[model samples]
Target: MGCGPSQARVLSQAPISSNPDEFFPYQGSGPWHTSRADSVMQPRLAKSGPASSEDCPPVTLQELLKKAAEEKGDKLALKVERPCPSLGSDGGAPPAFPDEEWKAWTYREYYDESRQAARGFMKLGFEAFDTLAIWGFNTPEWLLSALAAGFAGGKVGGLYPTDTPETAAFKIVHSGASVVVIEDKAKLERLIPALAQRGEATTRIKAFVAYGFEPEAQQSVEVKGSAKPVLSWSQLMTMGKEAKDSVTESSADPLELRLKAVEPGHCAVLVYTSGTTGEPKAVMLSHDCMVFETRTVLNLARAHMGLCAQAEQERVLSYLPLSHVAGAMVDICFPFVATATTPAWVTIYCARPYDLKVGSLGDRLRIARPTIFLGVPLVWEKVADKLRAIGAANSGLKKKLGNWAKSKGLKNSKARLMGGDGAAPFAYGLANKVILSKVKAKLGLDCVKFGATGAAPIRVDTLQYFGSLGITINEVYGMSESCAACTVSTDQAHLWGSCGFQLPGVEVKAFKVDPADISKKEECPRAPSMDDLGEEYQGELCFRGRSIMMGYLGQPDLGADHVREIERKTAETIDTEGWLHSGDKGMITKHGMVKITGRYKELIIGAGGENIAPVPIEDHIKACCDGVNEVMMIGDKRKYNVALITLKAVGANGETPGTDQLDAGARRINPNVSKISEALRDDVWIQEVTAAVKSANENGKVCPNNAFKIQKFMILPTNFSEEQGFLTPTKKLKRPIVENAFKKQIDMMYSSSETYVRYED
Candidate 1:
């Protein structure tokens, strides 16, 4: 719990401001530095449409921070809460974090410390515009380093904590990072040797800063064979503080000069995408891109939920992977903008990744009481499943009361979906007070005004399940290239399955293309209505705006070949007219709502050469089959489609399997079998699963034609997991890898004449 010297602490009696102008008064023309030619490409916009609104003018990270310091100086900016080590027993038990006190940092202290860290970078021979690669989980140090790099006129990239040593080294070398910030000594120990092995590739890394060390601890750690030592976080700050008075050949320290010389259009963040095929691509997002998105989100939130800066501020939990753009946007960029632009200063609570698993999340949520929350589909599914289990255990009057309350909640939410306030029913009010409110409080979601789901496909049933519990999980659609969001579902404009309307300033369209011959394409007309869309209008979703990234990272300095390679890759994504093709099949309504269907690459073609989207079909099967974890459709070039299903099982992390022991839901599917290994052989389990598949195929809503139905199916012994390289870091399935991994089982399913084949082990 003792991290180091406290950077800042929350004051018991900080003055509150009601006026926005008094809270943040700075407004100035910003081309602070000249645009550098270092970028391989710059952000491009369409021929017509507003790139940004006049209300939210473009600003650099430096400008934004400076303004915050000037106006919201004493406001709390960040807080880290962890259980006291002294209070927990040393019996290998988890820490009790519920009532733990948080260490806080005000805007003034945060900005000042980041500047010191920036000066520290200059002391370590860090040059302008160099990339700073961070390999760690969410923490104050991780955020500080990112801001420090931006202050030093450089861009920063994050490496997933779960990334392998080779993958981490590759990203470090590929980005040409001058410095790397690792979470702790343990990760540093693992990464150093791998970097050392790279030899010339890693020579660009002039220094390594180790975070999570005590303030008075050793300044540097020496590795066995390496000549250079890794500097501790405290040591980096000390260097920055000392460098404040030390003038070089120049008139002032390089920190101030870099700040003055950095342009808003320059790349500020590097998000490495985990592509299914090859090496991860480093997405270059500019300062303007991030700022534009932050401002736009604020506007949307204010319009929908009346989100504003006031005496009562918004609290957010930063638990998602910092490597992902959505996490960074909400946890990092959003807070800064909220503090600077409005009177309600935001407070960010940092949580470790482990806190996201099952029961641990509730502990953090109960403490943070965040106003806004975002989760992937898997996270929501687990939450709903957990609640379902708890509800099933209810007895006597509790069971009857719970059932009655849930029905009321579902009716209320469904009413809202049809343009009603959902508050007209007297029973609805009583239900919320008696049951739904208590349920929300227990989950630490009582204060959550906005809940969202994104990153991967989510089931409609899961969304509806949350609605039954009085939580509306708004769906959002975008990629890392679009700075996290292109379309967002809000309270004002929401449809259960839709991704919602396009952002105010952005332009979006669905272009028509044949699944077999995608190269030949044309722009499809928008549907006359939001609900009714013809098949002809369903096409590849595309968008363009100022929020779009500058370009993918390139190695132009290497030569013409590298330059050409960069151009080729860029052209594949962003067309000449600046529309960034999303690679997703979707349709846009005349009302501007967007509904994403599936990925073009994941489209399955049958023996009759009929185009079929597998995701919706897979989703339907999972929804129909209780205790089913994952349903993958396979029939790319066959007579009919088949499925590979994974049952819920006991796991270290709830989703990823650690043992074959069946979970409660899975066991309930067949009480005769207690383990997945046994359940696979049970005739009852197989019969039930077969019936579910039959139900899904016959449901006209999902599968309109016989060609789209899943014909044959087999249950996989294991789940598709990231640890097994069958899933991406975001929990998205690597379709080709999954198909290749189960080739034998898939072939066996098709070879058999039976409708449902049981693989003989």
Candidate 2:
């Protein structure tokens, strides 16, 4: 998703409005509304300098650092993006939303804190060869741990906060970390029993540092260990403060201690990627590689989607786990990179801030009137739910009428459904003005220039709803193995259903398709490759660039299995030599853009001779019905498809859709979630989705048994979760785990139609 075309202005300071654009500082410098018909994308951010490539010598990240050091020694590096951390219960939940007045650190302050944390770890006996394990949700402290560890010349292992106790302890022991940073005492308590079971491994942790602690924490951390606990977040920064104090009027830079400690090519981060078999393997990324990849992200065409500092307003609401590459890149690397050297040039207003939380995390996103926002698909889905709920709360008829009008391309209009239009849907802007707009006002996301949806494909309808609200949906595409920078749909050429062009500095080409399997890759269903016709070409996507990772850590066997030099062929084509084999299968479009279809390993092999990719079914089915939150098609080796569905709750969005004479204005099950859920379970649409998934797979070879498409499925009361071991950290369900966990429910689905059935939008 990218920004759609820019539209004309309609200004109003008040949050409530007929025109959605008015909430934007339309009266301010930027235009408010954008044209619906415009090409999809947010307004492009103003150039940071001349084009980043404008410099003749060309500015690599290393070169930019060199320039920043020489010209702006005393300037900021990284700082707290908020005024101060909100210390509260449930891991700082209530105050996670946006605030206009808050403390944000300057680059100098951030650098100082990181250096101090590095020194503090050092003081506690951590050294270059030692490892410090950090397990926590995303927060300033999480960022500090990674940065400080890197600066101190030590490698860090980021264990997910929600990891099973066994898994947590295993990763800790595996990384050989001598120190551990805990977010709070509750997590520490959970770790103690598991650690105790590991004997020598858990005892090796010499010190524990707690982040986001409440006053009731002291008694909870008493485990049977000699290791001391520390709760000096405020006191720990004295080193930086003291260093600042020691500086004289004519003193050299006070952050010299922090600067000289960093070294590239050292072990920077250890991120774990689960394998097709056995346990998860650690991917070791070098400092040089990590920094360069982050820079590649900075160079992406979609960077303009963020809130610009120039808007006199800017903010980032962060909730992604800092342990993962995406979180670390955004919170620790991207923010530092963006704000560092050009502090004077960027004037981002501080508003939205994310506080640490377990289970679910959300915040008010205060953005520059024209700003960039990046989030995974789940975030947008939630936003859509909120909008529908709000709009439906008012007169259902009026809301329907309003939505219908808005659908007809009217921005804001008044419609009274005192009688007629009762059967129609709400006006288009109806949801925008009445429902989503209020949510945006509360979250302060009304001014967002554009936002990115990635880590998974987002339903186009979700993007469309946000578009109606005046926020552009910018789609992003990438994989963790590729340093998380890959094909992001740029403002131009952002075609629906395809990831945009290959990014600059990266060259993508399809080399070969197993001619025996050429029919599988054919566009017209098993047609031959030709000129005005086709030339069958497709396979595992191969990528070569600085952004590629340094390979799996300590797992040379795995590295040998996949990593290779770039491929270079007979026709000066590719160096067809050795290219890193990305596990995904894809085809090159006529425009030279790479279109990935599915994972080679995850393809379902059916007993009745149907090949399927569950994702496409999940995507299409979930889209066909508003009731289903997530759909996972199981039955990989079985005779047919079976699904495990998580319902989108009734009254979760827009007054449960319809209200009949039964006084069902806001009833939960009438047009209830279950009823709606059953409607989507309609056999016709199910068959259609099954066929679509099949078509996307082996290129449209329908199996003989239509009834076997999806004989039966269990509707789940709750969605899968990482902590529950039903899903991976990235939100992809763990197939085996999910099947085992829901075995009883699955049995019921097949043995009987116990799950309710009905139909409603």
Candidate 3:
């Protein structure tokens, strides 16, 4: 209302207004700091078609929140992330799913808490355009503060709580945030070292707030020869109360004020994404873009979460990192919309497994009875491994009854792993009613209505395992730059390896070997531009639409490289087009679904003259391994295949059976591991994975109708991590680290032996 926001430019998802005064937290800063003013308000036709009056008015996220708040002020708007209290220091027992102690905030509570945090930021001398840093594990406080700052139209950046002072400082200074929120003394202490190295580090960060600490807790600190204010979370409420009391009784219209400050074009989120070449790049996302993308996904996931027609009795368990876009949108935005629309109907608990260590997630799931569960590929693989472990232990009993059941037409018997299990892709009736059902019940996942998996490929074997258990794993494809979920599977059209169709309006196309480069001696010989392939051909996947990020915060070159625009016909690259060249390689299926092969950079060249995609293969391998946590395939320009497999430790202390029991299981070849492995090795899951690998080969297609196969492979011991320089913040592998760690095993595995010792974690 105050500023000249171009109505024509606003994004469909941008908020209609953000009344600074009407809202409890208010904008920590003024409108100048918001992404709306820059990215959306000055829109250059972000929508697909030319502007027209007939189009239905856009459903603004901003309007949605305010309306919901009005309709259900007493209803829960959002919940803060809380960690499991039961988890031991050494990552002992996984929290039981239904553990209720982890509830961090109710919707109304989270909204109020964030408002208070916003008020606390104001008391700490924070102003508009000023940024705040949240460094911690996924917890309610971190999320509350972040949203408060966002609503207030300020820049908010989340740093991993586990980050060293150096990494944390780099982001703090880069974002120029004056407020930093944390979880404990350990994270608080990091600032000291960072400030010691550079006094300016503390300059941008005027306050450090720790969550789950008492107001009177003596968490004081000093750096650069001066003391700093350490505010316990409880004290923040007092600050917000004080600040609210002091603001003029008559203030700017909350809705108008919000509309004035919010625009669609500005940077809304500053997420840190680690690149192959260097330090993390801050990926800037606009409010309008993110708000819109989230709405699409939320609507898609809504039905599964039982929010569709049920509208009530819904809950969510927040466990992913807040720094990641997926977690932020869901924990902060999704509930707000759901509340605004349904109000008082849905019940949600946003807590992490780490915070509720008292019980296993199994029990927590039972308590929450969450309708929707989202996770990464590693999680699904782990589930499969756990199932196999229990089945192996029960195979003997199953065998005794196997023939008897066969006589009863129990073709798809859910019995323990048996050769018969491979013949029938269905879950054994008894197995589901007994073994797996018990697992879900124990994990509190029995009532889970939907599941989402992303960040990596999930082998069909893994997917089928969950399907058999009566749990549907919804696979999503996205990246930090794409706000985490670009595409996801619904139970209706779910496929094993495909990432699913383009999200509602998003467009995806493959850019493989350029037609111009097909000549005997092509000019430049550059990587295939978008112009290379036609429909259904494999190539680097390039996409466009509202989901694209604004750019890297401080890295121009990298941002330019990622956001290339081009005309649809020529495949000519244009920096101005806003099309994102996703580094992921893929092919458009004739049916129009996208089949993501692997990362463009991670594609391995097989000695058999095939381009192999390791992700899918790795996905299956992890599925078959009892304790596999992560698997990295490495065989570029090498014969056959070899992998660096990090087995998931069975228990907190990496418990293994006694030698006698272990020998028994090992000697019997574990009917369970063998059956699962056989399914992976020949059940078409590994076949599909290896085929993807071969297709990625420079050799291109494997002569129509022929899918590539893994001639041979070796699975080795050891998992990679950031601490070990094996993974980036996004969880993608650092190939160099993995290759170096497994060079010897890889060499031997590819040798005539075609086998190696697989270690037990």
Candidate 4:
């Protein structure tokens, strides 16, 4: 019932379908004929269609880790770079082997360490189903802590390092976590005070474990009025070693007994939603949910990127926060799953922060040169902007050559989008040999065969812009509720501006809703056929699959009525039929690819009675306007759409400055043109953004009714960020929070007598 090697015998017995007519009926037609616009209409399903449960049995994380260690004992599992204080003096000599700072760990070593950590948790009295909350950036220790918790038969909840004290405390308290693992002293400082404030509510928390403590700095943090013991990483490990040695063969191993008690249906992790529309909720993902997602991703990689070969070496860079589902899948699960299947896969954990001033990501990428890369849209956008800025700074001839190569690459990319083999034109191949290849090598993407962008809607222009530079970033769509397993663009069948096809064993459909309906309880009619899909078939995207979450965690003791309400709402979301109602609005194309439009609750109903999705309008504005870092269309229930724009800080030369330079400028406290807020006051920058918005409206890329033909826009003094509670951890705008925070600004846009910026200037 397993896949790949485990199902080799079954697959060999099955007859392979080789009929050209069955695979590609219109082979004689040109590539453009295969586009979604003209392709045959079919139900939205996986490339191989729906798979039975028996075909892919669910496996637990502990089992997966154990199998990987047993199979790939000697293979490289992790690579982490640590500062070697012994090698060099901070004030004096440079260290030898500066480039060889990485500490390597094999699968066997990782397994042994994780097992020891599990025993340590047992010693700390962590029982089955007990919550173990981890807060940290991407590090080997973070991964080990998560796996160790799983091994100890406890569910793990991740807390983002950027979370404020109050927010972290809420998650920890809500998840009922008894053990909290902090990354370092900086995180501990923020969390300890919050935990102390909780008083009796946090009494269940038995211990606090902190890692990465500096040995030279002999400092101890005392939690005021709290008698709970706080243990260091080394102390916990020592306790585990002692405890393991004391155990006899006659006595049952506590860790082993707990592992045997684990079930596929048991909650493995509790991932909090981004809370874009409302307050965050804990999504309970079962062991089967994670296993299904991991297996589907691995299968997709093999089918799309040819990553299944035993000899092929796959490298992944873990940089994103493990608290997020996308980060957890890419940085933790993907590598572990791949290692279990093949020994050639390697994961590089990125601990160093990238300096925006010098653009260190490019430098790191050059070193890792990962074969598979996944990043949020912001990461990709920043890289794109950096590359464009570097190109603009180049001398006349070099800039011209680079621009020429980019144009050729764009042409090749467009052809590939239309289903043609991505072989570049003769001139393009020559240009790539002369310029593009070197550019890719310098950016450390020369070996990258697969690149993906998700977490938020990215501008099609941004995708094409990267493609023009020889990096085709495939857009993916998913949320934490689905265990980050949903639709994805593949090499075999993909379309520009689409999230691609559904994964195997997954079912997706659009539920058509009337725009005029404002009631929360309104149920839309199911569009079952192509004839029923009206203009703009976009509606609330719903799916049923093995990967959907069990349900949101409910507080049963709140009240009978409240508990009943929670159960009713949960039933409405997941339904009796097993379909999870995704709050996202999307449509399935004729080719079975899904195109996400916007969030259902975030849609704006204009005063003119036209329905508008803000994402397309915002994306269009950002693509047209270089000065704008973020644009939120805020005209809900208004006559026309007006935007709240946040401009990037400009330098002396009027160009957008890097974040580092801006931070330094702010620290100087000089009454000069250093701050982003000060830069926004410039008339020239205002006019630039105004003109960009006008151009975007005139171009009309989005639907006519939902166009960016806004009446007015107000420039905000500061950018929306997670620290300010205006943005989620994943960088998505918290619509309700932002709207409430800027209520005055929004009212002013409508009530003010100022003339709207026009296209005629």
Report each candidate's C-alpha RMSD, comma-separated, in the order given.
7.4, 12.5, 10.7, 9.2
1-761: candidate 4 lDDT, tens digit per residue? 00111111111111222232222122231211110111121211222322334444557877887888888777777876675232224223222223356787788888888889888977887777778888876677788888888888888889876778878887787677778888777777788788777665676577777776632223344444555567888877887888789889899888888888787667778788877765567777777778777777777666556654455457777777788898778777777777776535555546353222233455556667777788787778777766766775688888888889999988877766634565566698788788888888877787776688888888888888887876777777888888885887755555578786676676666765434431232334433332333445667787756677777766432335644564555666664445567888777655566777778788888777666787877787787765567888877777778888875542211112234123321222233445565555555556666776776667544646443367788877666777677777777877788888887777777787653431110
Residue by residue across 459-499, what tens digits does model 3's lDDT show?
A: 76666666555565667887766676766665544555567
Higher-lDDT candidate of 2 and 3: 3
Where model 4 places Cα greater than 4 Å from the true spot, the runs are 1-54, 84-99, 214-226, 353-359, 513-536, 555-568, 650-683, 703-708, 755-761
| Model 2 bad stretches (over 4 Å) | 1-101, 201-204, 214-231, 238-262, 274-278, 302-314, 341-363, 366-370, 393-401, 404-443, 509-538, 555-578, 650-669, 672-708, 744-761
Better of 1 and 2 by TM-score: 1
For each predicted model, how many residue pairs clash, with residues at least 3 apart or on different chains?
Answer: 2, 61, 76, 0
- Output the TM-score of candidate 4: 0.84
- Per-model CA lDDT versus the true structure: 0.75, 0.49, 0.53, 0.67
Error of 2 at 173 (Å): 2.2
User: Which candidate wins on TM-score?
Assistant: 1
Candidate maximizing lDDT:
1
Displacement of the residue 187 alpha carbon in candidate 2, Å:
1.5
Q: Candidate 2's C-alpha lDDT?
A: 0.49
